[model samples]
Target: MHTPASMVTGIVFAPLGLVLVFTAAITPQWREGQARLGASGPGSPLRSGAKGQGKGGARPASAGALLLLRSDGLWESCLQVENSELKQCWPVAGSYRRDPRVRLAQGFILTSLFLCGTGIMLACIGVRCWTDTPLRGVAATGGLLVVIAGLLSLTALSVYTHNLPRLGMADPSKAIKSARFPRLSLHPAGSLYFGWLGSCLQMLGGSALLFSFKRPAYPDCPSCLKLRVCPACRPCPEIPNRPDNDVYEVSC
Candidate 1:
């Protein structure tokens, strides 16, 4: 049976975190985006620049538009739903893309947020079904899951709790049980302890993925502090001579 949306968030976090959402291996959304980036790789003008670039002075950062080819010809896509008249992020500018380490941190955060969002969506769905299912044992179970979902979300809000590496995960999946109707968990529950457990698992998986990827930090200014210190002059380096005009400019 397809899993209920209520269980989706927990399940999402439990196995892989939301980075899986971007892996294309698990989620088509990410796969499409990856393929798009890959196909356009060399021709991308922004390829020579950062994932995003700052504009002329305060031009604000831009991530650039993606050119996607389909039977319909070429089009620009955004992370926001395509063709949505309401989305402002179309063209997707100024968003941050991370190197492995930072991206790893970000993956966990995004996954956590996704889980919470899904949990809320499912809770709303459950509420809509509440009137029809109150006498059903699963209805009570659903309500409990909703409450638990909210509480688990709050637990994650404590910040950086989701950094656990999956190597450390402890299994409660075996103990979690469902009384009836839409039983979940591998089992189901009224308490949400299992939901929280899934959240923790996601954190670990995200951390592991990040640790596996090497991260590179680009230098913003090669002339900055540490670089400015010449090894030959470490004790006391001679300052470079400057023209009179340079002194005047400095005085100015």
Candidate 2:
């Protein structure tokens, strides 16, 4: 007895969650930060004499430009130098492989995505409208998978968020060894928000699906159990009897 509301919700949200999770996983905007390059304005060394200066010189500006940096679930990082328009991407050195937290987060996120996909498939097959006889057990199992997927996603997100400070901190040894790389400060980007939203949707859809389980209405007669056939509309069978003469009578 799946209600129309629950069926619609599960159908809509499960797919929506899948799309959002996939989008979040692929996009590299999970964490973003910018580095300032040089000083700006009339008093700055980059800016020369008042020849180019004007009356509105009071508007101070940075002599150096900002460079954008972003990282994704895969630990692939991108750097946009001069401005955020130009992009160059690369792996995050050996940190992704060597860091335990990174490995755990990666595994959890990947697992969550897999579970979400599996749950969606199962739910599709078990949905009432798709089948003549809806399998309540199958739909419940799918809902369980979706719930687990949501939990895994939340765990992965939590782990990454908790370790963000450490991730952004520059290695003291490397900083002391070379002045080329400076410490970076990273902030949550659009993808992180998308992941959160996706996780919530998964949970909601799963719960709705689980609650949709109920016994289907029974037909009036066992003979009319066939799909789209009603007991009242079915014609009765004919009976044959003979005493002195053979005779047959049809009963409807």
Candidate 3:
């Protein structure tokens, strides 16, 4: 939500997005079924890992599923089923779902960065208005909002991190990995908390700054110092792709 610090936020977050996308794209592209355990070739039932130790052939319950069992302290993968006529090898687990916190964190970082970056672009306009004319009535609130929101984000993140010791598991938070079974980890939880906090600040700050961009700035005319007048027309047309000042007024 922090929109003011676009450049700073954008630079920091873009790399994270790229890293996640690359990891997603390259996740074990090879099919599990075709990959043999312990480099076994065709017709060889035995798998290399400790996971496939015992319970060969198949169980009567499942029709066409690989049965994993341990026997005599060894692991084995069951290739064929004993009962049903169906002939199929055991399937390797591959289901992966999106985590909401991760998604939110990603969005928050990216958005805040964008907002911050935009602030840089509009800096010139703000300066121009200050010099050329009097500040508009509406302009003051937006700038204040951006500063306040950014502070709020920092506060939220700090609170979340402070509370982490209460909610985290016994395992080392740093050891959590992409291949974890439960998927959720204290690392990510912490990251999400801080990430959202920063982003919200950025969103609010950036929004406030964005609002200030269009607000009319008035300055005393050079010749007529006594009478105050709006500065040269607001540079709305110059600013690229800013959000609307409000819901009802659609102007960017």
Q: Which candidate is the best by lDDT?
A: 2
Write candidate 1's Cα lDDT for 1-252 as tens digits: 222333444333434422322232122121122113221255554354323233222211234433322110001223322221222223211212322322443444345455434533443443343332212233223333333433434343322123222211233364334321112111111122333444455444333222212222323223332333222122222333434322111100
Candidate 1 residue runs with Cα over 4 Å from true position:
1-98, 128-252
TM-score of 1: 0.20
**Pairing residues by index, what is the TM-score of model 3?**
0.27
Instruction: Please give the distance, in angstroms, between residue 181's alpha carbon in candidate 1 and its true position after superposition.
Output: 62
Would you estimate the TM-scores of all the predictions? 0.20, 0.70, 0.27
Error of 2 at 97 (Å): 4.0
| Model 1 lDDT, residue 58, Cα | 27
For candidate 1, which ten residues in a row score worst on lDDT? 68-77
Native-referenced Cα lDDT, model 1: 0.30
Full ranking by TM-score: 2, 3, 1
Candidate with best TM-score = 2
* Residue-by-residue lDDT tens digits, candidate 2, 120-230: 788777776643446666776787788898889888778877876576334546543322334467778888888889989988988877875754343333333232322
